[model samples]
Target chain A: MNAPPMLEARGITRLLGEPPVQVQALKGVTLSLQPGELTLLMGPSGSGKTTLLSIFGCILAPTEGELKIAGKSTKGMTAEQLAELRRSSIGFIFQAYNLFPTLTAEENVMLALDVRRKAVTNPRQTAREALINVGLGHRLKSYPSKLSGGERQRVSIARSLIGDPSIILADEPTAALDGVNGKAVMELLSKISLDTSRSVFVVTHDSRILPFADRIVRIEDGNIVSDVRQKRA
Target chain B: MVYTLALRNFIHDRISLIVTLVGIVFSVVLMAIQIGLYYGSQQVITGMIDHSNAQLWITPIGAQSFDDSAFLKGGEKYAALSRPGVASATDVAVNIMAWKRADGGQQAVVLVGTDSDDKSLMAWNLIEGSVADMYKPNAVIADKAYLADLQVKGVGESGEVNGRKAVIVAITDHIRSFTTLPYLFTTLSRAREFMQLGPNQSGFVIVRVKPDASVAAVRADLQKNLRDVDVLTNEEFRDRSVHHWLFATGAGAALIAGAVLGLIVGVVVVAQTLYASTKDHLNEFATLRALGASAGYIHRVILVQAVLSAIIGYLIGMAEAFAVNWATRDTQLVMLITPGLALALFLITLTMCIFSAIAAIVKVTRIDPAMVFSR
Candidate 1:
């Protein structure tokens, strides 16, 4: 049998907010993430794309149904176990460029390795490599506040990629950048997705990111409307 | 990385860090001064006993301390001197007497008289003149600090003790009384004359144990011979005096209560300051959580921040405390900051900061990592 998908969500449902008026964020959503593919979950505002991404990242527990990372069932897993899964197998980038403002670019990237119990032998060297790969080698000592919008986003990407996890989750990765910077980030993401051992999952409503996607899945009203395979243009 | 995260976060908000450190420094200085006052007061209370060479003392029954002892009617000194283990014994008279200053102002003075020539229970730290000079009529040795109270300038000044003519024969320095009264040192004959008593009357008696004799045995023998007086070792008498002044009254307990209050305030202020600092970074902590940093890891980061605050605050506070000690060195309210006290204060400071970190940690743990994805 082929190896199991990097992440899987089957009949996943999620409830948010307090009872009496709690909103159903996801209603029986089913999805699977495969290695070597850049998949996009597209939807408008208030759609459950971010919620689904959170589930895939192991940051939230589904109200119902089975979720798994690397073929292992996430059902009944504790929060700590889910964190361990995310730490070891998954990386995340946010649209707002969640590079810790206090840390230099290299230190922000090293934080990923620091969170791991046992990973890279040489953290500084590995962090430099990750930043260099994301085209931030010259700005290694710069803090997030000192970097431009695009540079800060690159630092976040470097931080996400430092631990060498099997999966990358980007939440509206280019939503806050200008056109040239946005196009540059998308190109970098597309290039990173080419590594066969890694799967890239992005959640966004921006149509500008569609051409870089290897597969596109659209969601509306907390439900998937379509899933299609496409060749990257 | 934990230290890195902690230190960076600790210094990120300079205002909050200063508030936290100020709380810690205030706590340390307050506690150090209060405890130091207690030790200083104890030193003053027991200075006479500590300076004595006598192994044992014979005091009147029901005497609480040296200053409160009733005069022995007769024969306690002879009884102690007649004991087999006792080599020599001398009468020591201690009483609060009326002092008529040269300026016509009256003040209460503690008159201490010891006739032991081997320097037992005698006035120390003499700046001028000899103890032998106290034999000239009503001559006495006085401390320079008490010159204002006695209305005297230096040696050769004259004052009156209990309506009798008294002359300053020697001058000493830093010999202070816990009661803030002046101490006047004189010979036993002069003390008897000043207090209007006959030669045989005294308040306490000092006994010297022979070189080969056990002090406990000599004390037991003295107690066996003395009928109406209580025989005690010098150490036992000093402890009694200290306990009587320190615990039997509200003075020492007040100092302890103040120290405890300082500690409580320190913890609360630090806790509030740290909680505020942590709240300032709650978003980043949530981001760390969502990025797969463990709850334990985040907790460690906050605790490490508290440790840093504690160490820095403790050093600054100790420096301030030492300065306070130095400032009060020659004053009436002296502070004695020993090494042990400094170490204890450092440990207490750490506890306070760590205690403060718990409040910050609670807020951090309650944060939902999913919040990072929302905005």
Candidate 2:
């Protein structure tokens, strides 16, 4: 008997807009994530990959779906309950490196721990450690506006990892980076997934970082076209 | 952390935060000045009553207010004194008389006349000279606040009142009337001479109650004993005088309207500035929401920002108001900011800021965390 997946979605469908112009963003999409694996969700623009990621992050409710976190059914969870679940179990990284411009790198990372009301002996020290792990120790006192795009994204990645969450969701994490910085961020994500034994789900259309993924799922329109497992080189 | 974030955000956006603070400052100062003027006017209206040591006042029948009293026979003072519990009674002759300035220019003055020997009924505060100086023939006490309007130097300056040479023997502080008319305090006989009235004429009778006597009881006794005259406690006369000037004259309504207009302007400016600030930071707030921050947390952040603006702006505005008050200290329209008024205005500033933050709070509450994921 294998352990249940850390996160699972079954037959998820999302309809957006009003009656006369409703658009189905996701249709019966099914996905599962296990610990210690980096899963890449690849799709073109408007292909529902981001929509599925939003559902996995607990920010958007699926019209029809059965979602589970740590094998607990989220079938009828309220918005507040979903928010609590997200705070405790998931971490989100945006492509735009959505760090508060006013907050220093360490402060930005500390926000995740503060929001969850996690009892850490020293939040600043914990945030410092997280930033140092992401190679942002030297930039801990710098604000997002003072950092490069890669540094800002690393700060965000540090924020996502600070809580030691069960799952990490990254939406186009490397979309704003150049080839070198993009590769560095992808490798860092892969290493974090293996080192922390946390599931990493990344939504990206960039193919240059495909070698770092343990599994790849491709979506088109509103459905997943393929799912494949690959041996990391 | 919410406060910390709010402070950091405000400090980070220097230009916008300064603009918002400036708006708040303008509102606070406007309200303080307008409200200060209203209080100053009120003080002026009740100045004479407030300074007098009389426990009760006897005016002619049908007199509507202290300032509008009809002349009574000078013997009314003896009738008031004969009442039980009445310690002493003195005739007070109040009339509007023309004061001839040194340059021969005449100004209308509110002349207050009482027995010079009655020390208890003298001006409450004096800046120079003593009440004994008023015993001199044709001597008067003037308020320093009206020296410029009266065109006099100080104590010892000479002027003519109703064609009689009158010398300013003393100067008092803040003894102004609601009409902004100069006040002239002198002996009863001198005032009657200045107004060209008969020696037996008096406008009002001021009475003092014994130490062990109840003022209300003394007032009732005087009311029952005095015929064809209205006997009222000092407080009643003061309130009646204030009400007559504040309501019947339309000055109070105008002052209140100015204060209310200041409040409205402050609220609007604060609301607009705070709303614009929230709009500028909408994306960051959305990101916070996406990171599992509840609506309450974001609301607190914005409210903290507004409260900070209010506190700092209030300090600046109060400083400016004090400066204005100091500059206009010598003028008849004094700007008076009492401690109670200051505390009330502080609360008003806080309320104004919180009220202004509501629009921003609503905007932040409606922010969709899903937008963070959108392109």
Candidate 3:
């Protein structure tokens, strides 16, 4: 009871497009994500999965409903405050493996540390340690262009883990990876959640990942049709 | 850190950076050359008036420049000496006449007539020979620059001026007039006789003021005392001499037009180059913004980059100007590139770069981070 859920969404709703032709992207979705939880959000294409992920990641705000992190409601928060919250409390792993090409793999992760406003001494060393945790210790100095697709995603994961945030939100991280590398990346995320108590929220359309999640929420056309934690068998 | 980023970014666009540097080099070199020639021409025009030993000149009514010839009916020497501020006064006679050269050619000269006794003001800047020889009846002084044109054999050489035998008694430095013509200094009696007039004819009444006297007060008193006569300080005369030479034709207009054209070309080149570079890097800047860099941070990077480029380019350009100056030190075309002139050019170049950089920034700031994901 002393450790509250790291992420909570209460009746979250959002609309896209201008008035008179508004398209509802999310319809009053509610969820609580505790530390050590590995959750998967599965939906067909155009089912508002990405919209829900962006709202939870603080990159986009919901038009209605309260979103809270560590029991603090994110109401009337300024843009700077949201950025600060993202920097301090949440880590994001994009599907594109958005590593700046000009920087080395280690420096790519170190940039996350820089944006987090942390007073880390020797960011390269910290970045190397994070990479080693994700099994990319030897590829620290390689540029993003030099790394393979799997290694690039590992670097992205290292970048997200560099800030040691309470929750990690990943959007389609495995969509670009092949089966073997994708499975490897998913295993890494599960290990991070169990070993470090960092709640991991992943949005994916791949059914292969459903077995790996502690809970699975299924969405169709923008509404959650089923929320199940485990197989009945 | 932002400086480091800007430098790296600049290095990335090596070709653009080189083009920008070349533009600045051309601008700075042109500005230096233009300013040097402008000031050099001014010096040439005002050199004689600046070096003259006279404190003031008194001419006929409303004449501010020496070209406005005035006639005094008498040897106003005593009349000027009687003034309260006058230290000494002498009658001067000036005439324009042709002198025979050794080459059998005739060169026009301003024949300046001064008293042989007033050696202090008679060919005072003697580069060669002696000013004291003016005591000789038909002796004349010429400027060293006109030595080849006059084709005089040597000192004591004779030449015919106004149908009278004139000896090359001495050569003086900086005796050339604003018209780029040579002046021949002669004794007052000879000049008066050569340029025939009534017995009382005098071209100007020179006046000298005491060190303790106020120049303004002196000028006012003299203008009042000598009714219908013009009186001016030495500085005013120098200004008028320069102005007269500058405005005589359309030369000043041409020089000014050239400078203005150079400025326009420089601003356009820098602005266009930077703007193009910005457009090419729109994606890169959007990526940086998406990575949490603030607008202010991006602006700092651009501004610092422009300043660095300006400084490097200006220094290289100034070095080129100095090379030109050193190459032409002995030539008549004075390439006087002063530090003040170089500094002014640098400031102007920097301002143009800043304006151009701001233009680039305006285009850059309009790029939204969403563009990185979409386009």
Candidate 4:
């Protein structure tokens, strides 16, 4: 029998704005994400791709429907509970490479571990190991301001991976980078998804990096238009 | 690590941090100077009672304060000395008189008359000349703070005091009065001569207890034996004097109002600066929240920043206040900052910063994690 999906969203709908201007950002969107799969969410600007990613990451509560992470239903959870769940089960990467400008590369990664409030026997060692995995060992002590765009994003990726969460969510992870650096980041995400205990979700409209996705789901007007699986090259 | 985040953020934005620190420093200095002036004035109000070596005071009935004591009849000193536990008793006469300056103007002076034989009950901080100088006929000791006001060159300068020819034989330091009257020390006989009063009359009687005697017991004995008069311990008289100047006359209320105004201004400035800083960094805080940081954690970061600002600002302010105090040490307007006052001001600065940080904290706590997504 197959393993349970790492993330599952069923008939989730989200409404935005007040009366007289109410808009639906997502509607009856059902999706399942398996471990060791690199899934890409692609759509136009107002197609609710970002909103769907937010719901999947637990950053926003669904207006109606059930969502589960690691087989636990996230229905009726408080904001604080949802935050705690995110800390333990999800890692997020943004397109801006949002590393704290004042913190060093290693320190940025250590912040993730610190937020988890887990018993970290040697945080410095863990941070250094994460940075090394992202090929930033030589730049461990460099601040984001002193780093190149690619280096900063690597630090951000190191930050996301430091917590060893079950799923990684990347929102336009390569939109700010040049083609060479963007492909490099996508390759890294692909490698991370190959680990059977982990899953990667990328939300982007950039079709140039489509070859890296193991599964591509297209969204339009608050609905899922297509879901396709492609064999890895 | 959380504190490190706060420290780093503070250091990263050096310009804004320094600006906020300036606001805090301004507040601290303003409060310190105002409060210090209030304390200095209080000190001056009880200066005579505080400096006297006597353990008890005997005054006319209904004597409300040291400066406003009613005259005691002749032989009151001897009567006090005859009581048990009263080892020594001396006459003291305190009367506000006029000193005729060389410029043909008169300045109000607080004339303090003590027994000629008991020098210890007189001005103890003589900076120029000795207490023996007051024993000379028509001799009076004036505070150095009144050199320009009284228009006297120095010791040995002759002036008219209360319409009597008197020589300023000694100059004492810090013998000031809260009423802005310069203190003039003299022998009881000379004071009587200056005031043109009967030889036996005095304003109060200073009583000293024996080394082994309990001052409280001595005070009670004196109170009982002295009919139609009030007997008070030294501390009681000092408090009475301070209370009269502080609350009874409304001077204390005015000074306190000034200090409180300074505090309010400081809090407002600090609150505005910190709120602006937090608003500038709202995006970063939201990002942290999206990354699973708890509200409690973010609150700690802001509090740490405020406390750090308070500490730095307090140090700079204290240094500035001390410099001002030192620069004005010899002036009529006394600025006194005691260690206790310094500590209290430091706590006030911390409280001010914390109060100011509340505005920032509220803004931070309201930041939605969804903000990071839109950005």
Best by TM-score: 2
Q: Compared with the true structure, what per-residue lDDT tens digits does model 3 show for residues B1-375?
A: 456556766666788888888887787777777777676677766555555577887777655455445567674666667778788777778767788887778988778887667642467668678877877768888877777767875577777887778888888765555555568888888888878855556777677788888777877888787766678777877777666656656565566666666677677777777788767767656655555555666677788778877898889988998998888654445556777787888898899788778898998777665454331
The parts of candidate 4 lying over 4 Å away from their true place are: B61-64, B78-88, B102-105, B208-229
**Native A-B interface contacts kept, per candidate:** 0.60, 0.53, 0.02, 0.47
Answer with 1 or 2, whichever has the higher TM-score.
2
Cα-based TM-score, every candidate? 0.94, 0.96, 0.77, 0.92
Over the full model, what C-alpha lDDT does candidate 2 score relative to the true structure? 0.85
Q: State the weakest 10-residue window (summed lDDT) of model 1 chain A.
A: A1-10
DockQ for each model: 0.72, 0.70, 0.22, 0.63
Which candidate number would show the highest DockQ if scored against the true structure? 1
**Residue-wise C-alpha lDDT for candidate 4, range A95-142, written one tens digit per residue:** 887778778988888888898776778998999999999888999999
Candidate lDDT (C-alpha), each: 0.87, 0.85, 0.76, 0.86
Encode model 2's per-residue lDDT on B51-98: one tens digit a residue.
677788888886766567368855788887778898998888888878
Worst 10 residues of 4 chain B by lDDT: B64-73
Question: Per-residue alpha-carbon lDDT of model 3 for A1-233, expressed as tens digits?
Answer: 25688989998889988999999989999888878878899989889888887777666788999999877778899655766677777777777777766678887787777767678888778989999999998899899899988899999889888878888888888988899999999988888878445899998978777778888888777788888786311
Model 1: per-residue lDDT, tens digit, A82-132?
889888888889988777788999988888789865567789999999999
Question: lDDT score of model 3?
Answer: 0.76
Which candidate do you rate higher for DockQ, 3 or 4? 4
Runs in model 3 deviating more than 4 A are A1-233, B52-78, B88-208, B238-250, B327-332
Give the CA lDDT, 0 to 100, for residue A151 in model 1: 93
How far does residue A11 in candidate 4 sit from its true spot (Å)? 2.7
